[model samples]
Target: MTLTLEERVRLFGSPIPEGFTVRVVESGTVINDEIVSDTKVVANGYDLYMTDKVFETMRDKCLSKTSKVWGEAKS
Candidate 1:
């Protein structure tokens, strides 16, 4: 079954705020794209957007960034 963005965020602590609506999309990059989880975060119809590079960097650093703040919401 497919889950919505909010569900995913709720089930797994979000690195981004859930106060606003967000949409995730695949970022098609030419270089080694197959090995990378390229994603873009779009909020409120592109009013705010995170590039794939920025997204990936943030994702890679998320655990460290929010670990203390969110306090590990996993089992």
Candidate 2:
């Protein structure tokens, strides 16, 4: 049962920020030959993901740019 953190916040009707992805995950680390585990959910280690809306928006913005930064990108 994997639950993402963003949904919890969006459940309250607050919009997520643009160009950013937020999520929570289980993490752990080893210290002094002992496994120090972070059982609490957190964000790290590529647990983050891009929203479809943000990806599309970024693609559109890149396609719309004509400043040569996009290198003649197709529409």
Candidate 3:
């Protein structure tokens, strides 16, 4: 089952930043060429197989857009 952003935050008590998704996987599920037993975070070009706390912290830094960029995004 796929966990929505809101559901993830509420149910798992983890922050799922924008543009990312959480997926619940079955046992022996192949993810990123590795066998996964539980959940995975689907990123832009890859999947992150991690626990709730690690995923929460990583997503917060990587996808939250909280860091400053050197230049403005060009349209």
lDDT for 27 (candidate 3): 53
Tens digits of per-residue lDDT for model 3 on 1-75?
Answer: 886654555555455545556654455656657665434443335344555555455566443332222233423
RMSD of 2: 12.8
TM-score of 1: 0.33
Pick the winner on TM-score between candidates 2 and 3.
Answer: 3
Quantify how close model 1 is to the true structure by its C-alpha RMSD in Å: 10.8
Clashes of each: 0, 0, 0
Candidates ranked, most accurate by TM-score first: 1, 3, 2
The global C-alpha lDDT for each of the candidates, from Candidate 1 onward, is 0.49, 0.39, 0.49
Using TM-score as the measure, the top candidate is: 1
Clashes of 1: 0
Quick one: ranking by lDDT, best first? 3, 1, 2
**lDDT tens digits, residue span 2-21, model 1:** 75444455566764555654
Tens digit per residue, CA lDDT, model 2, 1-74: 44233342334322333444544222343333433233332234534333444445544644444323325546
Cα lDDT over the full model 1 = 0.49
- Which runs in model 3 stand beyond 4 Å of their true positions? 1-14, 38-75
Mark the regions of model 2 whose C-alpha exceeds 4 Å error after superposition. Answer: 1-43, 70-74
Model 3 Cα RMSD, 1 decimal: 11.5
